[model samples]
Target chain A: MLLKKRKSKEDTALFRLEENEGEIVLWSENREVSRQLSMIDLQEEDLLVLQKLRPLVKENIEKIVAQFYKNLEKESSLTKIINDNSSIDRLSQTLTIHIEEMFTGVIDQAFFDKRSKIAQVHLHIGLQPKWYMCAFQDLLLSLISLFDETIENREDYNKAIKATTKILNIEQQLVLDAYQKQHDEIR
Target chain B: MLLKKRKSKEDTALFRLEENEGEIVLWSENREVSRQLSMIDLQEEDLLVLQKLRPLVKENIEKIVAQFYKNLEKESSLTKIINDNSSIDRLSQTLTIHIEEMFTGVIDQAFFDKRSKIAQVHLHIGLQPKWYMCAFQDLLLSLISLFDETIENREDYNKAIKATTKILNIEQQLVLDAYQKQHDEIR
Candidate 1:
């Protein structure tokens, strides 16, 4: 059958991130993100809600990222992993991009792969799962507050919140699986 | 429970080969290699054979790689995809390393991902699946001949052949899945 071939391309930037002198927070406890990974049905409604939140997330990206770092930096113990202001700057940018990507509305195999890599990186840098989990929670709350303001109806706001939470939970689970996989490998 | 951490890494180099100045061969038709892919059992016997054959495949690596290239070059039309002598040399070296890697006795998810990338590259380069199938056939023969020479017992040799074939079949099936996925995506 005659079919036009699209140029196949693959970029594993996720795996390429080396042990840069950036924010590498070391927490005593790590969560196995991979083991906790389970398929959450991202229905059409969820996709719609996510897409709607994209602009709001984009607008608040800087503030959201700043606040996340602020929370992380407040704990003097955590600042040890931050390396320097330059590292925080880079990480803030990365976190912003990552958050922007989440709003793409379609999470495929590639998405999971990136999350898996992130989980591995956390393990590599001695980052605790608790911190990562808390960071995610903070991101969600930031988004939710914005979401609440963006939506007029209480019912719609609740639905959007539910959808957003489901997707984030799914992402968190996948990330944890990396920790689980790593833990298994080391054992 | 305390556990040691293992490093995680992934490289999708197979799909990274873009339109480099080289050979391009086009047959009138492309096979649905993906449709041809189905799960083939990899028995313990197969793993044993693969482990045993590892050194032999290694020993004859030069001869085997030469034969593979010779087969590819024989088709004057396919030579269009090979850029030059340097390209051929580089590809030959890569093929040798890849073949050697297969004998590592464990085909994990990472292995499948690499093979899948290779399949996608074939489609992207407009190389027909027929060539891959033929190349694999050539690889099988080269190994089988070596197997025949290395093993004194015919019965053991037959068992080894059975094992090797099973493993190769599994690899072929994975490569085919890429085609199937791409075909579905385009349609």
Candidate 2:
């Protein structure tokens, strides 16, 4: 499937930033933003591959999210982090949106902006990178299993998983960047 | 101090790719490379901060690397991995070179190509991401201590450490990308 060029930032209404003051203060807006879409090599082909998974993800998002939180809940420390900073209901809804967004395949400046904001929220909640990375690994495993069961064609399944991995890494990079910025600001 | 724009890919020769067949096969060459220097928002100023630390890193690299490996030696699993894959002396020398490269303050395609090769080597050695990250945290702590003791001004120390962290994260992202590629290739 041929994927069109990414739409202009103004063309997309999906990744709108909230006007909340806490979020504004938390967001690292002044940092010199660069072209991230290129950095991770997220190509139009990768986006096309991801767009194809939209239906698969939409159908299984609830199950996928449930599996993710179940794994997170296995550790008491992670559970405490959630209880202290956010409720399960709130996090579940947010994550469902996040999963759907991954398959939207419409990356733009706003896409990175949203990831940046999420990264800040994670920082505010005192989520350590190790735990975050661990959780993401679990999520990736779940997605791989989902694709394996759902997608019969071997090549297509590989393409789908590969595409998913790239988008997830992009998300993780933004989080890592935010974590570094927080460290820079702490003193 | 004003910094010059990044030098083109051809000018300097710090990060030369090796001609070893194993190295060539391991390096993910056909993968579409992106402008990562921008992706991580690594600027000339960060390079300038790192460049200023060249002498400091140069003088104490031995001590810093010794501390890093000493910390690793405490972990039996890490020691076993080193024993199985490589000797401490060999790894130590490679790490010393790696740490010095971090402070060289030069980044271009060759710089990234070199990092990509290192990531492949790590995979070939069966070094898990968890262990790799744990080791990196130790190295960063050593550098932080080095900066804390040697750099007089608090602000300069912070800038140096932040710059170091960005370059390190860039390296990590490349590894993560390579790891994902390996997973994609595994079947």
Candidate 3:
């Protein structure tokens, strides 16, 4: 037997697992999304793993963010660009929220929708793809290091990371398309 | 002539660059430290690059944060972790400050000091390293993708990342040491 529930967004994604099964399965538009995307089936041990890693990620994010700003300030070229509008307080707040949300995971349709909107926002601003990729790599490496202990099974951990990277790559491409379309419209 | 300056906590360790006089000049206390710690000198173009990317990063971070909290709400095992803590707001505030500072090139000694303290607090609570690392990686990836437009050269970008990563590794080790020493004392 299968259980189905619709998430609020336009995607109408469903969370599924076998009836009486310990894990949950996720489906979108009558097709199965990856199990990793489905949170319903997370076993007790899986939940424990996520719980254990959340705060460490939060803390390290704070550190990486601090460092990123410091680099921006010191670089004379980057300074003038931000001189008019940016502030340490504002940037820090933005990063904090972002990092916090990563651990918490996404559940709401509104939340996912907001992310789609943010992708549009990036297009308005003219972000380059390479820069986005570089930043992602740095952030990923730091995060992996932070969770080095809890990920006792290096192979599984690596697989999880590869999966994440793949998803992120897709997300990046989508944003890039949105950005290009916006740019063409403006031109 | 080499310009000597007092090391600021915010300053990346100095390294060797060919001087105008064609001599190798040391930028910091030690060659290795300098090599490992130097930040990219910002140029006007780089500033423009960063300016374009900043907002996207900001937007992405916020979206990620929302999703994170939503996921936490859905999970049974994680809810209690936040039961007694009103600290999420405080943490968010600190994170905002931290990210902004990264772009501004200003080093906040107080901020770093606070994070170090927070690490201790987590350690006291028995938070594992893996949790922090996972969250950190997630945030890092999100922000990186947000800033994809500003990165010019992948090689230089990767080098800078390596430098930053090394510094973070050092910082994490220090925090771990402090926590361990304190833990030992409590015992």
Candidate 4:
């Protein structure tokens, strides 16, 4: 029975697409799309909160990104990875875009595709999850500090932090999901 | 400066090997292999604790593995994945071997290789981390229950549980590392 299923799967174009180089068609793309979002408990309200913070994020994004790399560069191994696989300038630009998009308050197909692309790129460069998680943790701290520094209302700041945490969780989930998919294919 | 580093990297065979299909030589392999072990803080004492549990684990692995699949089969989506991509019998056999190996309590290159292979196989089959994590969580609870039932000493049980958690964390780190390496290669 499994053999028959494998045979049918092999005969499909999608399977071939997976077999092709530099092309990824996620299995989830065929299933219920919102399942992952639901898994993270990201909702309309969370998106709204993020959307509300867009202007603030925009105001600090340049400073936030600059500070992110400045801190990242202090690690010697990561510095080599950045220098060899990519540059600080390039990473900073990409991260700026990534941060801006996080606050866009939309979870559409396009958003998933972009997130998947980021995950794929990070994976291709052999970025360990340890470093990735660390990098994001730093980014999160900076963002939270932004909230503390700027947001006047405690309640609103708390809500914003919650929303940001959920969004970041969603992002990490995408990266992990992508990593899992590729990890399977590696063998 | 970054361009010079990139150029030098591209000239290396390791870079070429990375670009080639079905060949993965992780960046970590060249560095201190024990780095990941240190990160998880899996020490000699923890290994000793797990070594002590080997006899009990050997006795109950069959039952634990059986219960694992029985619980996993309750998830309809996972069942479909199993039916389509692999057989319950094969997975059960591999998992039994994996569980047995965990108790052997040796952290060597061979052990790391086996764990990496397991991670790669799961990735190829498109297992989501959510299900992977849930399955392991279930497995961990069963292992804890085993300690509860068999170990008469509370201190012994507590030590065993902590060791088990560390071993599992080490296992997970291997899986995540493999995923990250492959994630980078997917592009």
Candidate 5:
């Protein structure tokens, strides 16, 4: 009889975020799973909502980038990644454009295509999924805090968060399925 | 009789992941809220997770940043802001760090401290939340996908997620109460 592989709790990983010039990166160790799931595709209404949020989202991205760099200058590991003033300046400009587009929205093809490319990149790098998720979660809290002042009705904001959480659950299922297949193959 | 000020969803703001350097950044228009939050003081466990995920998240941030720049390189309104490559690079790096930090762990005093800072930053910039919670939800999906790959057990992972979500709900309530107090003060 073939024995099925059992999953252990101790084997679980964590998620996190990272900073590169002006952009925020959600990093993870589970590249194969993330890639297999095709996670970034947005529904029609999701796109519409994102489009509506473009202006504020764009501005928020820029500010988050600026502040993050200012903080990183204080860290040693980051110094190796970011060398000088010129490098920082270029990063900020690139980040502004990036944030603008994220809020603008994307179609399914573009989203999936990007995810595939990202998967390829991760495979090349040999990083794991745990690190990425932890970093990304940190990034989410920062963004939420950034927008805290504008949240006039706490109830509505909470409801929006609930909606967001529902979507995340769906995405998680997709990612798990993808990871399982890959793990089995590796074994 | 005095009339109460009616709050509108239009007054709310949204946040998202923007690309800079080789990473992602959290962006939004609402400066006040962003300034109030901070992503710097992540827990040791969270930081460990983020460290592991850095590579994959960085690549995705770079991809998003590149696409954003490609689009902006054409538009007249954004050209002035993104004219220089150096600035773009700096911005990307900054954003990568911020994004890496955001998703690393559960929200706590450190998270709240960062949010307070972000809120202050937004106030200075004179921006507002635009996208509501859609972009945030997308960011969460990316993290979840990564998590699935690194974690070997489904039951343990689910338990962690449930615990985290409950904590977040509690945090949300505190945030709401604070907002109500602030609103009353403004009134």
Candidate 6:
């Protein structure tokens, strides 16, 4: 299931040399390339753990997104942000696919770019960072609960949780890094 | 200091009538009309009280808006929402005008519609109702403090606060009413 992403930009221009994880990287100074790196944080251990947990997360993704929205609506403060039912459903489907793709354990430049785009969409709609944090917390808790239900082995479950968390942490880092850059540029 | 607002919308479209606060209001069913109303809930006593306080609120408006944004930025959650320095300055000026117009005691159809539009802008940007409430609280406290400094009579100070509060309440009501309508439609 390793889908190769298209090389988005032709690397013709001069790029600054940088070191990444004991490897030499020629980084383009272009804003897009400047913000991205060749680093994909998933390790062999994380990948193996994630591969096992992927199916469980996939099956429960719908329920997780539903519960997330339920929590959001319960807070009267956030009710105003909900669009029509159809739009919510659409966003839910998109998020489910996003989660499924995330568990693929093939992090790449496209993945980082997609995370940046998500940050941009939130910022464009004036969504504050607190809401994103709230969402991430909900998603984290939901996935952990899913694992708690299906996983039998304590040792293996612990491994799964750690791997899932590592990927989640990387996802968050990508988003915040993009957010800070855009925030600084706008300011 | 009653600055008369130019009538921006022509009453060409047919509007349904609704009674509010014992007044016969020929309200249009238009989204703008459904969201707005004739009176902004400022009573005669409140208006008279607000008239006296208007000049002072006008004088300290800049300081008030600055203090509002300053408080918003202090909260780590909201810093990401702040645009560049110049954009913040521009919005502050717009908000200052909005606050001044609010106490005009002229809460006509135009005022109601304008309040609804402000609600739309906030909701469009995914700004939660809590932030609006927080802002109103800040504005309210700032204005009351300003009145306390200038007004000698305790009774007049109390009256000023009441008048300001009544208009502020009406402003929230208009925004929330519009927000609900939009939320329902989108749902």
DockQ for each candidate?
0.01, 0.02, 0.03, 0.04, 0.04, 0.01
Ordered from best to worst DockQ, the candidate numbers read 4, 5, 3, 2, 6, 1
Q: Every model's Cα RMSD, please? A: 24.8, 19.6, 22.4, 19.0, 24.3, 20.9
Compared with the true structure, the alpha-carbon lDDT of candidate 4 equals: 0.64
Model 4 DockQ (Cα-based): 0.04
Winning candidate number (TM-score):
4
Q: lDDT by residue for model 4 over A60-114, one digit each (tens)? A: 7999998787766555677788899888889888888889988776776787788
**Candidate 1 chain B weakest ten by summed lDDT:** B1-10
Question: Model 6 segments beyond 4 Å from truth?
Answer: A1-187, B1-41, B84-86
Better of 3 and 6 by TM-score: 6
Name the runs in model 2 displaced over 4 angstroms. Answer: A1-39, B1-187
Kindly list the per-residue Cα lDDT of model 2 for residues A35-130, writing each as its tens digit: 333333356667766766777788889998998787776567778988998889999999999889887767666777787787778878777664
Q: Over the stretch B41-152, how does candidate 3's per-residue lDDT look in tens digits? A: 3233332333333444455556656554554454333445555554556656656655543433222354346556967777666554433333444444444333223333
- Residue B18 of model 3, lDDT score: 21
DockQ of 2: 0.02
| Best model number under lDDT | 4
Model number with the top DockQ = 4
Q: Could you tell me how far off, in angstroms, the CA of residue B112 lies in candidate 6 after the best superposition? A: 0.6
lDDT of each: 0.57, 0.62, 0.42, 0.64, 0.39, 0.56
Q: Model 1: residues >4 Å from true position, as ranges?
A: A1-39, A84-86, B1-187
Tell me the docking grade of candidate 4.
incorrect
Each prediction's TM-score against the native?
A: 0.39, 0.45, 0.37, 0.48, 0.34, 0.40
Specify the CAPRI tier of model 5: incorrect
Q: Which sections of candidate 3 miss by over 4 Å?
A: A1-52, A71-79, A149-156, B1-187
- Candidate 4 local Cα displacement, residue A14, angstroms: 46
Error of 3 at A21 (Å): 17
| Per-residue lDDT of candidate 1, residues A50-142 (tens digit) | 665566678779988987877675455456776733388788888889988776666556776788898887777766544565466556656
Clashing pairs in 4: A123-B183, A123-B184, A124-B184, A184-B123, A184-B124
Error of 2 at A107 (Å): 1.2
